[model samples]
Structures are given as C-alpha cells and as structure tokens.
Target: MTLTHRLLSPLIVALAFSAPVVTHAATDPSFVLTATSKNFDNYFPSYLANGYFSTMTSVRGSEANLAYMVAFMDYAKDDIARPAAIPGWSGIDYSTGKSTAGEFWLNRTLLSDKAFSDYQQTLDMHNGTLTTRYRYTDDSQKSTRIEITTFVSQADTHLAATRITITPEFDGSVQLSFPLNIWAPHQPRFPIGKMTGDEMLAAVAANNMSVTEPVNYRTADRAPVWYHGDTNVSNDDGSTKDLTLQLDGKAEQGLHMAEAAAIELPKGIKPSDITLDKSTYQLALNMKVPVHKGHAYSFTKYVAMSRESWGGDASATAALAKKARSTGFDKLLAAHQTAWHTLWQSDIVIDGDAKVQQAVHSDLYYLLSNSTSGTAWPMGACALTPNYAGHAFWDSDSWVFPALLLLHPDRAKPIVMFRHRTMQPARERAIQYGAKGTMYPWEADPETGIDYTPHFAYGVFREIHVNADVAIAQWQYYLASGDSAWLKANGWPVIKEVADFWVSRVSYDKANDRYEILHVTSPDEAYDDVPNDSFTNAAARKALDIATAAATKVGASPDPQWADISKKMYIPFDAKARRHLDFDASVPHDKITWMGSSLAWLMYPNLDLPMSPEIRKNDFDFQLEELKVHGNDPNEMMMVMLATAAAEVGDGKTAGEWLQRNLVGFLKPPYNVRSETASNNAGYILATSAGFVQSLVYGLSGLRIDDNGLTEAYAPALPPTWKSLTLKHITFRGKRYDITVDRDAAGNAKLTRKAL
Candidate 1:
C-alpha cells in the first residue's frame, strides 16, 4: 500500500510536515521525514539506530558538536557502592550507565563557516537511511553541492557507513577532517536529592563527599581508544552530594570497547596522503578533498564499534572497519536496504488514512531499528538514548515484547533470552532477599542481572511483579513460536522459577482459603506495600498456570503447588462496583489519580482474568476518567491500552477518540516519534511505540494469544474514521497470516484472515 496521507489533525502537524519538500524524488515521499538544519539543536536531536549502534546528531551536515554514538553493549557501573560511601544494599554493580560508545564527525565549524544554501536532512523510514544535502559557495562565488548519506547497517550489525559525494563548480581543495572520540557526559550519580548544587560542591570540596574518579586511558594513539574508570564513590544522605557527585567514567571497567574509522578516498587521493592526529582518548583522520569542476568525487567512511559484551575484540573491531571499507558503500547500502525491506514485509496497513499509516510505520520502524537477533540484552526505555539511565523495566516484557513476537519472532528472542541469561542472577538475588525462587529486579542491569533500583525506591524490595511479567513473556513467546527446544532449554526454567517464587511469596490464609501476595507494588506503581494488587495476582496466577502446562511440555513432573496457588489466588475485586480493585484496600469509586491504572492490563495483554462486559466497562470508564483529568500526567502506553479496552467494551467512539488523542498528544512530527509523556519529557520511548502498535494489531484485530493458540476473542471495533486496518505477515505457530478488519456494508466490523 502506498502511504500518502496528510496529518489527520492540523494542530498536531509539525512545520516540516505541513510544507514537506522532498529533495530526493527517487525516495518515497511518504516515508521521508525531513527537517532543515536550523530545526536541530542541543534540545531537538535527530538520530538513527541499527540495533547494534546508534548515532545522535544535532544538525544536518555533520555529527559534530553535541553529537555522539551509543552501542547497545556500552555500559558503565552506576554509582551504587564504594569504599568511602555508605554500603549499597545490593553488593553487585548495577552497570546501568550507558556510556558513549564512540563519536565520529566531520569538522562542523570548518564546513558550516562557508556560505551554504538549500540545506536539508531527510530520514527514509522505509530504507533506514539518512541523507543530508547542501550547496556551499566560496569567496570566488564557486559552488559545490555536497550530499552525505549515512546509515548504521542492519544487514551487518557491527558496521556503519557515511558516504560523502561532492560536485563542485570550481577546482579547489575542500579540507575534511574526521575525529573519533569516546566519552560520556558528566551527570550526578544520584539525580534526586534535596541539597542545592553549590552546597553539594562545597561538601565535596570539604572532603565530606566523594565522586567517581576520571577515566584513565589504557590504549590510545593511531588505533582505537580503550579506557575505563572507577565508579565507586562515597555516599551521602538523600539531601546531600550523592546527587551532586558527577560520574566521570566514559567506559565501564569490564566492558571492552574499541572504535575506529576507515576512510575510502576518491581515486586521485592516496591513503598515505591522509594525516593522523592522536590524543589520549581521541583519533583524527585529516585530509583535503580534491574537487574538480562538475566532476563528482565520492568517499565513504566506515565505522566499527565493538564491545566485549557483544562478542568483539580490538583487532576484530578494526578488521570490521577495514572489511567494510573494502566492501564499498554501494553494496553495503543495498544490503541494508534489503534487510529493512524484509522487516517491512510484516507491516500495518491502514486504508484511507495516510497520516495514521505513516505514524504506525514510524513506530514500528523505530522498534525494528533498535532490535537484532541473537542478542541477550533488553532494549531500554529510550532505545538508543541514555534517558532513564538506559534501564530495562517491566516495559520490555509487558509492552515491547508483544508486538515484536507477533511481527518478528526472531527479533523477539532477545527479550526472553535476556531473562534466561539473567536467571542465575535472579536466583542469587532471591537468596540475598531470603526468598526461595528467582526474583527478577524491577530495573535490571544490562550486562549482569543486578537489581539497579535505588535503595530509596520501594520497588527495590517490594515490587515483585516483574518475576511473573518475565514468565508471562516467556510463555507468550512459546505460544507464538511453538519452539519446543526453546521451551525446554530457556522458557521452562524461567517459568518454573517464577512459579517457585510465587509459591514462596504467598501467604496461606486458611480462614479465607486463599493464597495472598502481600506488600507488593502493582504495575500502577502508585499503591505500594499493598496486598493482592489486581494485576499482580492475576499475572502471578497466570504464570503459575503456564508453569503447570510447561512442565508437561518439557517432560518434567508438574509442581502440584503451582495449580493449588493459581486456583486459590486472591484477586481484589469490588462486588458492588463490578470492577476489579486496584488493590485489596482501594476504595471503590473514589477520586483517582490521573496516572496509569494497571486494571487495563487484564483486558488487553493478559486476558487471564475472568471479567464480564459490565466489569470491563466499569474499570475502563473509571480509568479513562482518571486519564482525562487535567493536572496529572498520563503516560502514552496506558492511553493506548485504554483505547484497546474501549474497543473491547463496544465503545468504538471512545476507542477512536482515545487513539486520536494519543497520536496528537504523545507522538511528535516530522518523524512521528513518540515521547515518554505527552509533555515531551523523554524522546524515543520504545514502550510507547510498542503499545501503540499493539493497540492496532491485537486490539483492533481482536486477536488474543493463549495456550489454545491465536484466536479472535471478539469482533473488532473499527475506528469511526478508518476505512480499514490490515496486519500483514503476522506469524503464529510458524505460519504467516494476513488479518484485515473493515466495516461491512451493514456498518458492522468484519475480520478476514488469509494464510500466506
């Protein structure tokens, strides 16, 4: 389907979208997100990622000035424990800090100093390529048109390339200098504190506080720079320098990272002509471009970033850059395009609404950009950025995994593999907490499965739902893929351990004859230290049930206690209101906070709880009213979930309205990328993106995944303004299918499924 729609809402359309100038006619105009060089600044960043590595640039022409790259594997130890500091509760390092993998850029000051005109940057969402074009005129009025095409190769995960082509009106030299630097920005280790910045600095100067030392270079010269530092520091009270102490390490101690670039010069320029400028933590490649009038000179720079976590050494990383340089740019571009094309095969097609189609594609595109097969690390909240300290939470299992599992199961493996890889740590954590089974942390360390939740947050000790969340994600993957080997090897163990954790956690109330999980935080995160949270109990019950069945699948004896616990699990409900209570003690029909309500999970993703239409409607209505309240900030994921709930409750108008509000409120153009909150707090939230896509695929299509396999739970509710919604290449049980939902002549929603 051709994507050619204007924004549905005029108020939400960005300035770039309103007057889009497609400088590249060969590329699809609908897939291209374009903005002027002036649109970019320190605050407004434009970025590209290829699952392995990502680069963020401030402007159109170069990756200079406030530009950096982050590899998925690059992480440093968070400031948790040190010799002089108050001992951290968890002895292990969280390793949640996402240090800069590398930075490579042409000298922006030198290039932008010359007079330039018609500068524009366009990101092709369909092909995963970014192209920037401009014409520079010298003092003699001689013009040179320069076009730079950049892409992190999806085909070859470790390789990234930038192709620079220049055509000049006069024969002259264009000096080009490229620098590679590996560094991270300075920020407080503990961000939340009561003390003033100046006071904290004074305390540090007075030897009352301590900070992580600066990074020390181990290897630096003409080759890739390798460095590490000590993150351990002295602790302070919540009111003091703990929040003021700046973390100085660029790379973590155990994470071996090496980055270098190889330049493929034009035919006339010799390799030996380029000069190398070296520093302690940086390397520069300097040369001059020999420009001939009306003769185009093309040069490609290949960058390779390797980390020990992702299976690469210094020699291997350098060899990758060299190999990519030898392979040439055209072949690499073609391979990258092919990889993207394969991913786009499983796409959401919205008929009669071009803007919605574009938005959906952009969301899926970003998720795909941040994923790859055979990796055990979870995608962070801000997929490529260091926002939220790059920690993976329940967001990965509950929101992000579903969409990927349905569309691209191979890519979805990492989300579950990460859990399996960290299960040992989960067991160790449970032992430390005096619990029987595995307990996944609320906020996990990417490298080691350490509980990264700060000691102050109750989630560090009380939020236990992540265990079940991980188990449910694993079972869902099994249901979708039907991979028996994976079930026995990776899936069953996690599921069984989660069941064991719940077994050890619940209290046996013989008087009430029920199993109760006490003092836990639900997905809502508002009601802490509560008993029997509706979502938590339901999820845990479902995990137990899955474990019982998985035992049979893996040819292991079923744990009898799992069935008993699941059968007697006490889920909070208000009989009079006919709605599941947020927690056992939550008052029915009380004034509610405008934040997200976890009750929606029962209707959308889980579907394990037994609820009548009246109950679902009551809960959804109450939550929707809470979201509508003006003062509180409601996240985008819940809005998407509520929209799906609206559809399930036969409220098509409400569903359509909420979906529209989400598109307008959370997603920003010209790229239609989603921020964490409606207030534009954090950019490129993959959870929000995943939830939006899930709302369309599973919500609008009425498809539900369970042990019985993929089945339509009910008739889909088509959005009022939508002509039709079709999901292509939906893989279930190793078969691909296309499902389309549209209104029949009678104005009733109809769903058609075709096997491919």
Candidate 2:
C-alpha cells in the first residue's frame, strides 16, 4: 500500500487520482487542481488565495480581463440601510492580502484587439499553481497565441505578477484598449450591491450606490508605467471602502505606448494626451509592436490592488511592483516556489492512500492560499469571494482556527486575534443592540469586527452563539501552543470579554426555573429565533466555563456568573427518544426540521454536554434523518462531524463509511467544486478541511492535546478497507509530532516527537 511520487508541472507531486493512486514522475504528469476554467468568472476557483490575483477562467481558459479588489472601511460596520449613501470605499484583498478597494481598470482586449477566430485555450493546476494558455486569430485572419502565468508574490504578500508570451503568425501590431465596462466596480450600476436593476439604477442616479468616481489611470515615469488610484466602494451592508488597483507592464523594446479617451480612439486622431480627467474611468492604453513570423514577444506585468486603510501608498506600491518585475520572472518564481515548499513542509501528511492524500492536500492548499501570517483578514467565508462585504465570518473561529492551530499556528493566530482587536466594536455593538459585554460580529472584518451578516437572515439578531465559538478557538489555541505568555497578553482579555458577553446575553426564566437564550438562531441556521436550543445553550455554558478557567489560569478571579449560568442553562432533551431536541421541548421541537449537526459539535470539539453511548447513538440517528431530509452534499458542513461522532463512539465501520462518502461525494466523485455556495466560500477552505482533519485526529485516533506532550484516549479503530492511517509532522507549540495508526489485532499505532 506504499505510494510513490511523480513529477507534475515541473515539480514533484507525491500522489495521483488514477488507479493504484501512486506513480513515478513524468514530464507531463497529472495535476491536483482547483480546476481551471475556459472562461473568466468572478467566482472561479483560484490557484493561490495566498497571492493578490484571481486566476480563474470558464470552460476554456480565457482571461476576459476583469478585476475586482477587496478592501474595508472604517465608516459603518453595522449599517446596512441605505449603504449607497456612504462616502468612501473600504474593502479588503485583491488576490494577495487585504488592500484598499480600488478600480481594476479592465481592458476589453490587449495584444489581440481585433476580431479573431478559432480560439483555443488550455489550463493546468499543479498543487496551487494555475497556468493558462490562449490562442486566437485576429480580424485580419492572422493567427495569435499567448501564454500567461499568474501567481501572487510569495516574496511580497500584497503583489501579484503575470508573465505573458506572445507569438503571432503574421507581422502585425498589437493594440490594447482599456475600455470602461458595463460591469467593472467603477460603474454606478454594478451588480455588487444589494439593489439590482431599476432599484440599482435609482440608487446610482441618486448618487447613493457603492460606486467610485470615474478616475482614469495615469502613467508613472517608467515603461510598463505604474497606474494607480483610489475610489469609493460601498456594499449594501453599511460598508465604505477606498480601494486601489495597479497595472504596470514591461513591454518589448520595439513597442510604442499611448493613452487616449475611448471615444477619441475611434477617430484615430492620435491625441497628444498623457493625463486623464478624474471623471473618466475608461482610459485606453495602446501598444503597437513589430512581430515576426517565428519570433515570440515576452513581457511581465506586476500589479498591486490595495485599499486606503491598508496604509501603503498605492502609487508607490504600484511602482515597487513594477521595479520587482524588472528582475527576471524566474527569480520571482524561485522565491515563490520556496514559499510553497515551506508551507508544504509544515503540513500534515497522510500515508497509505495516494488519492485520499491528494484530496487532503488540495484542501490544505486552499487553506494556505487564503490565509497568511499577521493578516487580520481571517479566511472569509468564501476565502476571496465577495460575500458579507468580504468580511470574516464565524466560520473563522470554528472551522479555520482549529486546523491552522494544529498545523500552522502562525496563520491561526490571526483568526483568534481578530476577535481581540475587534472587541471594542463588539462591546459597543452589544450596548447598541441592548446586550452586555463584547458580542462578536457574525460578518467580522477590518475597520472593525462589525456584524456584516444581513439583518433578514436572523444571524445578526439571534445566532449569538458565535461569541462562544470565538472563546472555543481561544481555548484550543492555548491548549495547542501552551503559550501562557500569549494567554496572559491577548487570549485572556478576549476570553474575559466574550465570557462577559455570554453571561449578560443569557436570561433567567422564572417560569421554567432555568437559564435560557431566547430569540436565537442555532448553528444549524435553517431555523430562526428558536428558544433554548441545545447547541447554543451548551455553547454558551462552555463559553462561561472557558472564561472562568482562563481567568484563573491568568491569576484573575473566576467569574461567578460563569458557574451560575452554566449550571442552570437549559438543554433541550428528548426523554422519549433518549436524545437531545433541536430546541426546548415545550417549543414544538418535533415539528422543526433542523439541517446540521450542531448538537454533534457539543460532543466532539466542545463536549459541553454529558452523554452516554446510547444517548449518542440516538442523537446520531436523529441527525441521519435530518441529513436524509435536507443536507446537500455540495454545501453542507456536517459529514466530518458525523465521521467524528462515529469514531468517537468506537464505530470504526461507520466512521470509515462517513469518510469514504466525503471523499467520494464532496471531493471526487459527484462534485469536486470544493464549494457550492457563494455566500461564504470560507466553508470550502475552513469548514470542509478542518472538519475532515479534526475527525481524523480527535475522532478516529482520539488524540487530544494535554500538558504532557501527546496523548490518546482511545486506540484508533482503523477501518479494514484502509491499509493504515498516518499523519506526519504536525506542529503544536513549536514542536513537531508524527502519528501512525495501523490495523492489527493488537491495534498497533505509534506516536513520535521531534527533540527540542
């Protein structure tokens, strides 16, 4: 069952998906990809969320030349009503790290400006690399071909670079037009806002849409001139971000460059203009170059999309990007390759199954691409997708935090620290929302950890359990890192603030003689304003306990409220069914069709509620029924939990079944899209991967972090179908450990540690 490695896309890929699943290196080896597209899509899967560019195409890998950046503003974090009235743009990210929202200045066609035919495209993804090749014919029936390689700068977290090679069949000129489009962010009627069609038009006419003024790009004093500007961007949810974009290309020596108005270009007047009006978003850059039949033209474009709040001068940043491009592309690529190697070196390794290993690595690759060290932008729900105004969601604390905690704690710290930094806004919101202490936002981001979840969804109003989830992540971080220094400095304060929030957020019910959370959305999110949900209540109770324990550990007094609330918190129990109900029994719990495994969360990660084996079985049986009714494989985040539960209860067969279903259903057989929902692709990066890895470590292998190095409560029950299960080089508190579980009558498994 040993696996062999193979070369892919100029590097060694250790696994494959074909029969037997392992092979030696090949010149043209298969790739483990996020899927390359034939056409450009805003939501196309990206190669490296680690960089600041999107490399997605539709059916055939076509650039289509559209760009959007993510940035955040300090204006209003929780103000969604009449968002168009906001004055400035505040957003985050443009393929690299968080930047100010700026215009991408899309071009209609570059290099091949005229009508062409027989278009052909090819794309490849190896690990996290995406390469796209395009070919077409110009209006004169002359053949043209180009290859573009895009990557976020590993050397610089906020830069992206592309190397383009052009080859033509005829000696013709290449002209590019930077025409303002109907859909770029600069347009007033851009569909990024909540209002669409007539409503959007009305908003735009009223000058209240999330739009930037038409600011034409300008040229700096260098060839492949650096052009950058700032513009206002708004979202429906009270967000105003000033984003900036940069475009600087180094063309061949025999090329000529000119800039003019899009309308003037039609007249072919060759206007002598080097500057543009601030009101013109569409400015054209024309390049005329000599082409020989067999010679190829090559150039590199360096770009940086930044936001005002990011604090870096966009113009200077753009200029720096261009300067870096002056160096050979191979040099930049070597640094980038080293970065990926470092990430992979620190990753969790799986042995015995090459296909399963590749799938795991794919999940991990997206995780690394989407998160970086010291960047406050936790992997947003959709990683880089524009949802919740590009804000980090609760998915961060619960899903993203744990996996990075186990493998890349450096990246995981930002997830937890973001809560700490945003606590002030959270507390202010708590007071504003008529609650106590710091209540973390569901759609949290920079500017403030403000709530960006829409009001209609009931998440902002009632899904208050996110506070506890934040605390849970903090607790897990401490356990993994044993960083008491960090605990005293940052972790404890957050624990205290959140614990204070939950204590004041809960209410005492004189009628029932218990503590209850009312008008709340449970983690399932399918139902709203439910009372006394077992998941939420249990989580709240755990939050209090964590706060108190953390306070004591930090030489502070434990909060008395924590004990009082947790002791009396109401948990919806089903006496007849021998399990827990979705909500309080008195609230018609039987009538509700809950859609997730939040209760299962209480069993695995939180373990807030005490349960017997039979009770666990009954709970799981009911959850199976819920999945039968509504859990769509493409979007659901519970298969990992089910597998964890199965492993927790010592059901090896069931655990293996759940794992196989996830591999086949989610990653390979049915839909390998990684994500089905655009609402927040963070689920793809965090929920899917974290849950899978957590199930293996904490579920099947029964591994739990303790003060005494590594410990396991139950011998891992390896499924008969698997030859063995092994994890290599997992980091905890600056140390690395490896574990292997082999199926034998004695249940032989081994754990080893690196010497300090």
Candidate 3:
C-alpha cells in the first residue's frame, strides 16, 4: 500500500458517516484569488490579575484584593493536608499527589484568615468610588489605634495616594508594616525541599514546574517575633491547639498557624467580643482579651493601591491591579467585549447560517474572556474564574498559536513574547542537564518560573518535548509576522540554543543509521518515556530546519558538523501502517485510543507538516469514536483543534458538529453560561472563539496559510441552516483579507474577497 492509503484506513471508514460524493463543476478560479480584509475595533483588557481574585475598590474608595498568598512552605504541612487528597480539587489526583497538602485547602485557609479574609466581594462601579474596613485588637493594656485609608487613580494607570493614621490611648511602642509578597493563580510558589533561587529560575525557564520554591517574599526587616505560649486554634481537624502565639506588645507577628485561635479572656471581657478600638491593651496576646467594647473593629484597606505602597518598582503589579480594580472581575472581560464590538463593526458577520454566526461569536467570547495582558502566566483553562492554578504549557504555544496568529496578531505577539522572556531560563536548564540548548518546561508558574509538577508519574521528569515546542513557536511567529529583524535579534539566539540542546540530547542510533530522540513524552500524558516519538521527531526536525534557515540568513553558523547532524535526524513513519509512528519500533505502543490526535498537535497551529486527506479523515474518525460524554471530558482545547481540522479538509457538517459539541458540553453548560471545563476560564474563551473563527474561515471560506502563502482551495460550504457569511480584516502575510459568503434564493453560494 502507498503511504497515503495506510494512514487513511481508519479515516475512510470514519468519513463514510458524512461524506459527500465528489462532482466536477466549472470552479471560479478568479473568485478564489480575490483578497479581502477586515479590521476589528474591539480589544479585551486583562482585568483580573489571575481570574480567581478580583481587585476592586468599594464605594468609599478603599481597595480589597488578595494582598499576599503562600501555600504553607513547609513540606511536612503539605503531607498532612495534601491538595489532591481533598475532594473537588481539579487536576490533582491524590494517588499521584506529590504535595502533602493540596492547593485548594491552602487557598481556603488564606481566604478565611483575618489578614487575607474576603474571597469574592463585589465592587460598586458607580463613579470612581472604593470602600474597605478591617479591625484588630490587643489583650494587655498597652496602646491600640485603628487606622483607615482610601485611594483612586486612572483606570489603566497605576499611580494612587493612600491616607493612613494611627491613634493611641496610652502609648508604649508600635510598628506598622505591610506584606509585599503577592501571588495569583498559576504563579504559586514551589514547596520547600528542592533547590536554590537560581536553580528554580532555570527550571522555570524551560516550562518545567517540578522545582522547589516557585514563589518567595522579600522581607523589609529581618527581626524575629517573641513567642508567648501555645494558643488553642480550631480547624476541620477538630483539634484546638494548632498554634503558638507570639507576644510583641508592639512588633508584628507572622501568623502561620494551621487553625483558627480560641483564647481565654480576663474577668469581664469574652474572647469572641474582642474588637479593635482606641485603648491601651496588649496586642497579639492569647486570642482571649476583649480589647474593644461593643463594635467590630473595622478599618478600610485599599487593595488596588497596595502594590504601589513602597515605590515605582512595583509598577508591573500595580498596573495589573489597576486593570482588575477598574474593569469587571474577569481577565480581559471588558476588553474582550470591546474586541467583539470591533469584530462586529468590521462587518465579519456570517449571513447564510444564523447558528454558525452565534457559534462563531460564542467561540470569540470564550477566547476574549479567558486571556489577558500584564500577567506572567499563560491563559488558564477558564479565562473568567480561577479554579486551576494557571500554568503555561505546550498546548498554548502549539495548538492555540495558529488560530490566534492569523486573526489576532497583536494579541498573539505578547503570547510569543512570554516565551521570549523565559529563553534564558530554558538555556540554563539545558546546560544543567549537560545539553547545549534551551529546554521549555512542561508546566510553569506565571509570576515565578517555578516547576510545579508534583508527580513523576505524570512524566514531569521526562518532559524534553517542551524545548522544541518553544522553537516551533519562535519559528511560527517569524512566519506569520515576516519580521526578520525580530528573527535575527530575539528569535535567532533562542533557536540556536534549542537546536544545540537537541543535537546534544539525541543519540546516534547505530543500528538504524539515524540521529534519534529517545525516551521523550508526547503531548498527551497517557504515553510516557516512548522512544523516537513521531511528534517529537517531527518537531525536532522542523525546528532544526527553521533554525538553520533563519541562522543562515542572519549570518550565524554553528560548527560545520551541525549540517550533517540535521540531515541525519530521525523521524519515524510506519511503512506498514502508513502513518507517523507514535515512537520507534522497539517502544511499546498502547493500543487504547486518545482524543486530539488529528489536528490538536499537527494541523491547527503547529502546521509542521500537512497530512494527506485520507490520514486526516482517519484521525477525525478515531477522535469521534473515543469521545467521552461526561466526567473527565478531554481538554476543551481538543474541540478547537478538531473543528479547525474539519474545516481544513472541507467537511462543514463535521466542523459544525464539533463546534456545537464544544458549545453545548463545555462552553455553554448545565451550570448556566459558565464554562464546563475545569476552572481555567480563559481556556474556554480562546478555544471557543478560535473554533468559531475556524468555522467561518476554514469551514466556509476554506482559507489556509502555509509556507507558500495563503490558499483558498474550497468555496462556501454552508451548513443546511445558513444563508450568508461575511468576515473582515482577516490577517495573513501581514495583510488583511476581507471576505463575504452568501447563498442565493436557490441556495447557490456566492463568494467575495478584497484586500484592505
């Protein structure tokens, strides 16, 4: 059998479900070449810093947001309360739970504390108003004072003023300090027990999340507190003695206890009635003294301006906090809505099918809601809310990049730049392993480049594919932007480093006479430590080619031996199976099926190599057969991949089906309009929006971009319910193409394109 037939065996059977009979007609060649463009006016702003917590000011202009978050650094504490062991925490499996305590429980504790109390408070956005009030009390007769402050500024700008004061009844000595350590979803600190700051930084650069100390706080003063005695605290454990109190009559104490405190009071006052007030009393004593009389001590804390308390050095965080404070509490929510307005204003509305139009918009809404700027982390699974500890992974760069690059180049640049910023870390990781190039981590904390992979069984230790994934992203950015200067400056060195690492890591398979990548994991975690993985080999070969081509143009040359090595690089294809081999022949292959194989890794964004029509058909069929209805649904990203792939192969019915599946199951759910996938709201938005765009461009207009240029092979393939489709400022080759498709009274389709 020929190479095409073998790969198509499964596809042909799958396509039979909805295959159209091929017919000859006078195709309009001129119409196909007509180029059109559309320009979108709407742009979504990154609102919530990390999606889980919202930074907002109350009516009185006081800011309230998560100031500082740390997951009890001690590993022993983690073992006692593993995040995975707790029910309802997503992505964490207790069987493979590496952390002693899971993230969910830790976050709960922080949110419930007197210091980090409110989780999701609403802000009244009428005028520039903000309000907040919190209080504290002391036990012994020292001096106590309560102060409140408020601040406000420009919506996008980060400068603000805070007014604070202290009142003392009988003064002794008192010091006031604020904690500057801040963390968001996807940027949690690595647990204690692993490495140093430099080593942790190196691990993060490669997209690995298995290192120790992912996040840390820089202290202003190193003075220690004086311990008083053990204070009984209450928790879910039913134990009341989980902490010891530090008495400082004046100094601040680090509250790191595991449970809530219950203190014994003096004669007339009760512990529960203690409140912050203007009086002389002992501060931070055993939780029992009633410092304040009848009222709950309330003081306003400006959450939005807290980042700017010290100096301008906190500009990045301040900028982020400002965005969240002013806009709605979701990443890029308001901005995304604005972006949609611009998209609609550009007149890219689908006319033939109303369902298609709504579906496309729904997808775009998902994308806009889930992604943002000024955040070090990649978009989470859901872009609106925070349930998943947001981490950047290979899926974003590989599967999502293509769709984002074509229509949203401006938004796409930052995503690419995120990788660029981490290149040094990747390079250092390669060096540590005695390899020559950059190694991207499989998972990475956004704020701090900490490896967070808790389990070795999840293939955290063998994640070599991430390096090539980064190289591919760099190459794709160059292809879409055609920015050679960027390629020469920022892109070239990183590519060279990645290329060097691959060369050093791969072994010369003497028996096969090819340079082979061994013991690497594919994108899907089900298969681990496979030899000469087809996807890995293909990416490596492509990275090498692009890096070499770009390097040659930029006048950078590696040792002459590099050319010979590139030539001998191995990519395994099964002759008998007529498909790309999952790994080398010697490696065991799990015959069990997996979703997302068809276009998830290859076609949608990576675009490394094109699959034959037959192979594409088989892959689609395989995914359909393996589709899970509920409970642990496959990654929502897979839906976008399949939709785009279906459009590429000119299967409108299938494309529509997949789009509907995503919308109904994950995008629009039993849980009202909230995303059904895990809590990564941004993931829901990007995947759905990209899926809709694909339904219009790839499915209806049949547009595809490759090395040669943009190709419009197929004409309008309107779903049975559609009437017309229009798209504007669709970008390709740094030029915008405006396109419109409509079906006439007799259901005959019409096409129009113009370059803007």
Cα lDDT of model 2 by residue, 70-175, tens digit = 3232222223311111111111111111124422211223333233233333222233444545555433345556555556665666555555566766663443
RMSD, one per candidate, in order: 11.0, 12.1, 17.0
- lDDT computed for candidate 1: 0.66
Candidates, ranked, TM-score: 1, 2, 3
State the lDDT of candidate 3 residue by residue for 639-734, as single tens digits: 666766666666666766776666553433211122323222222234345544655655566665545566665555555555666777777667
In candidate 3, stretches whose alpha carbon ends up further than 4 angstroms from where it belongs are: 1-348, 352-363, 369-386, 558-569, 585-600, 622-632, 668-701, 713-718, 732-734, 741-752
Measured against the true structure, the TM-scores of the candidates, in listed sequence, are: 0.83, 0.75, 0.57
Write down the lDDT that model 2 would get.
Answer: 0.52
Instruction: Please state the error at residue 496 of candidate 2 in Å.
Output: 1.0
lDDT by candidate, in order shown: 0.66, 0.52, 0.42
TM-score of 3: 0.57
Winner by lDDT: 1
Once fitted onto the true fold, the runs of candidate 1 whose alpha carbons sit more than 4 angstroms away are: 1-28, 37-43, 65-116, 137-143, 184-250, 270-273, 309-311, 586-596, 629-631
After aligning candidate 3 to the native by TM-score, how far in Å is the CA of 263 from where it should be?
A: 36
